[model samples]
Target: MNVIEMKTPKFLVGIETRTQNSLEIKGEGKIPALWNQFFNFFKIDKKISSDIYAIYSNYESDENGQYDYFIGYEIANPDKYLNGDSYVVKQIEVGTYSVISPINKISENVAYSTWQKIWRMNAKQLGGERLFHTDFEVYTNDKKNGQQSLVNIYLSLKK
Candidate 1:
């Protein structure tokens, strides 16, 4: 895990949902449906980076509680897409992050496994205390035929 500082707020444009970790563990989560919405229903207005962001924010308490999940792209235009229908804009506030890059590559299944590995980790393994406010996974544009080869999981950390 590597700690990095984000000096500015980053904006993401796409679909969102409120879910709990328990729901996801049971495989009855809305996040899967949410991803389908992103690929099938999401409209990309402006292009910035091809990296796909799976952002977790607005925590009710922590990883054990309900929080907002968003899957989208970093957009160049936020004001134009603020109609508030199905599309929503979320701003990732500036903070410190512990970035953990999984040894495995992309795929929904692999992402799940990575989280499983993380959950099994101890406090010393985490490097620091977790904030769980705006943790996210970045699917970098390093693949062939519209596939990503790596996913970097960024966990928000307490100062």
Candidate 2:
């Protein structure tokens, strides 16, 4: 559980979709896979080739148990995302986010566990159900000692 607290001035939205209690979120675009393949082929640092993302879910809960619609985004290098021929790329509004550190790429268990910790510790301080705008897990293709090569978790906050 390698954890780091980061604040990005702005990050572009990547993907938007729905998710449940699943721990690991799978790859949905070719760019992400391509980036991973490129790094592995070159045996280089697990860095994203471009900015890539997938909106994971739309429904989020508030403090009062009310439902709010939100979108998710996966962050990656902008250059890699532009060069990939795998999926259609779209530009979205960028916003500040409280970013989490990379986790062990073990079945996305790191993502689920990080979220639980965030909800338990920071949820109260963040805001209401509207605060659940969206959450995303960023990944790069690298297997270090069978651990995750590149990845980050981001949560959209009310700012």
Q: What is the C-alpha RMSD of each candidate to the true structure, in Å?
A: 2.0, 8.3
Write the residue-wise lDDT of candidate 1 on 40-157 in tens digits: 8877756598888999999999778999999989976688778778787888889988888877656658888888888887666877788878999888767574564688898888
Model 2 agreement with the true structure over 5-25: per-residue lDDT tens digits? 343433442322233433123
Worst 10 residues of 1 by lDDT: 140-149
RMSD of 1: 2.0
Regions of candidate 1 where Cα sits further than 4 Å from its true position? 143-147
Q: How does model 2 score by TM-score? A: 0.44
Off by over 4 Å in 2: 1-17, 22-54, 60-92, 102-108, 123-130, 141-148
Tell me the deviation in Å of residue 30 in model 2. 19
